[model samples]
Target: MLAEERLAVILETVQQKRSVKVSELCNLLNASVSTVRRDISTLAEMGKLTKVHGGAIALSENFAAVEKDMEEKAHLFLKEKQAVAQYAASLLEDGDFVFLDAGTTTENMIGFLPKKDICFVTNGLFHAKKLAQRGFRVYIPGGEIKCSTEAIVGAECACTVARYHFTKSFLGTNGVSVSAGFSTHDVNEAQIKSAAIENSIQAFLLTDHSKFDQITSVTFAQLSQAQIITDRLPDAKYRSFTTVKEVL
Candidate 1:
């Protein structure tokens, strides 16, 4: 195929899959490794995609401006996120108070949680309403709600979360790094996440493979602060400080 045609195909595949590995793209396009890499580099430079070590992901998946349209991310990495959520839900006991973060991965945990006798606190308005509708005791923190992520965060939300000590808290972040720790795009949300971690006896960081190294604007907590639960072990750079428990 021509270079333009190959690039178009690559873009379409990345948009459809949300992420595309170099080898997979090469195989699909019947192109050389060099050709695939060059195409990915060119697309990334044009701000069409974000290139990672093994693959390239659509830039739209990470942009906050488009987060409200969660349909774009709902089907991406579904199995991996569900596995991570199930593992996270298993950590809770019958009477334990839990805090759930706002993210696609964390949202999966709601379906896995038991329907009765649990107190759940969240800055995620969607989670709060879902749990409440299911007859579980749910508390929605008071604060400014960001419609994009359906998260309520601000000083008020932080204060409310601080008042209630949780048995466990499951958080999601935009990025996880040994040096930068857990980071998110919104400062207010980061503050609420930090508060949740501090108020919980045990904290778990839940993320999928996509969140490995990409940094965001604000740092919430360090790798040392919580046990990391993900779809797979992170890169070699994070093996030391992060206690990774891979969810099958």
Candidate 2:
């Protein structure tokens, strides 16, 4: 295999296994330890993965640090988002007021929602038109638009979220851990998310399993605030945080 192919395999294996040993990579890639070590060192230097004692691990925190725009995010974990959205929509009933957090996962909710009388209050600028097109009552507060996430955040948006109490709220987060709860990289976005959870009757956090055990810059709400709706759990270590609804 070429050097590039070897590097790609190493990264993929590290991501799939979260962490990988030098021996494992040697056997998997049919490469010598020195060659695998060089690949891991190069990837580590490029900030693609974290180099460990004997191997490398995918650095989710590093990925979380450099935030991706909505267009980039929408394509990731598509099937998992679909499953979570379907399950989230199932929790909705007729005549319920909801807050849909600005995220690719929560954006999928509208497509899965039951055809019923429901009103949506969202900070997701990208979500408004789609919700309106679907014949649901959609409300987006006027605030400064966040270019990266296409979210309306800051004090004005937080105030808007606070004014109305939602029957149920579905939120998305960068990280959801027992210690840090729901966290994101942006503080301005965090304020709005925290407000939505506070003003809602029931809060649900939608995230993929990758979010577990990783924390971002700003923590929005505590783990106890929202019931987690995820595709799967890496382990039962998250039991103390909240009730987890695993779609798997």
Candidate 3:
């Protein structure tokens, strides 16, 4: 096919799917990787599409403005969340000082936690309660509890998290974008998440494949700052930004 035809096809595909991988375009256009990449670059330069690490995404990709409540999210990706949580929990060790973020995925990690000499600080009311029930020493910050997600957020939460030096932090994000990094809709929550990541020695983002290529209202942390643990990696380009572990 002609270069013009390839570019047209690429633009159409990105418009339809919001994102298209170079390899997928190669297969669709019956063109070489170099040809697809060049076409993507041309479109990006023309402001027709945004070129990501391994794919092209629509310039107007969707942003999540609202968060799903725990009950609504509990069953959305139950299996995938469990798998990712299991892997995250395995990283815990004796004498570790951990920070657990509030979200359905991070909450799933509670059951898999082993009995160990560990201390945890969390901003999730549900997470703190679960951890305490499991006989793990847990601390919860004093802050305004956002009922929608049952997470504590505000100046108090961010301030409390800043005081602790955590060995590891497991955080949840509403969206993960190549340009925007890890994001959430609420600025207050974002502040707390950012504070936790900054105060921790190592940070891990726990999310599912659905998060990639999406952005939210506020960015909490950059991609390079944290390792990612997900059920699957939809794009290879994400690995270049940080370490990504796929549980399944």
Candidate 4:
């Protein structure tokens, strides 16, 4: 295979297994040990992997080193998130079936929820408990736990979410633009969010003002698929793509 093909295979294997020794990659890729080492070194320099003493680990596994964690994100744009989430929670009424996405902004919605009968299906590991505590019947998907985002992701999450139909869906995003639509840092988590949108009667994407114009690793849905809920609309260009609910 070509050099590019070999490099892609090596990266995919490491990401799938989380870590891979040089000797295992050499056998799997059918390449020389020296070539595999060189590829690992190149990927490490590019921040795709972390080269250890004898192997390499996927960079995504060390998410905190690259991006802020849940606690850190909780303090950012606190008022804006609360305002937007409060409005989102207000949309909930008795017997409404909904989705509460996994993110700091969506997490804020739990606090602002009114005393109403609602059933929630969520991939947010922490969100399930909070919603249940508020007397909302909550269901979580069976899936792999993504510690970085405090979410349950992968195919199992998508399958579980697909089985239910929602009246309304509240989602979170890392980036929004007219061209790229809604994006997030992880593909697995993105799949779950996309599935939620697909199965909802009305889809609402919630994000802070800061996420505007910023694109992340994966685009989960088209801008036309959901209405945008945020603190402020930074750019007029997005108006052509989707409706924006500017809380401020």
Identify the candidate with maximal lDDT: 3
Clashing pairs in 4: none
Better structure of 1 and 2 per TM-score: 2
Give one digit per residue, the lDDT tens place, for model 4 in 52-154.
Answer: 6466766643311145678888899999999999999888888889988988999999998888888899889899998888888899889999888898999
- TM-score of every prediction relative to native: 0.71, 0.75, 0.77, 0.73
lDDT (Cα, tens digit) per residue for candidate 1, span 169-245: 99988877554578887889899999999999999998888887555666799888988998986475566885788
The lDDT ranking, best first, is 3, 2, 4, 1
**lDDT of each candidate versus the true structure:** 0.82, 0.87, 0.90, 0.84
Number of the top-ranking candidate, with TM-score as the measure: 3
TM-score ranking, high to low: 3, 2, 4, 1
Off by over 4 Å in 1: 1-69
* Cα lDDT of model 2 by residue, 1-248, tens digit: 99999988888887776667899999998989999999999999988898865777677533356677888988999999999999999999998999999999999988888989999999988799899998999999878899889889889989888999899999999987554568899989999999989998899999998888776677799888889999999868677767998997
Cα lDDT over the full model 3:
0.90
Candidate 3 residue lDDT tens string, 87-186 = 9999999999999999999999999998899899998898998899889999999999899999999998899999999999999998997767898989
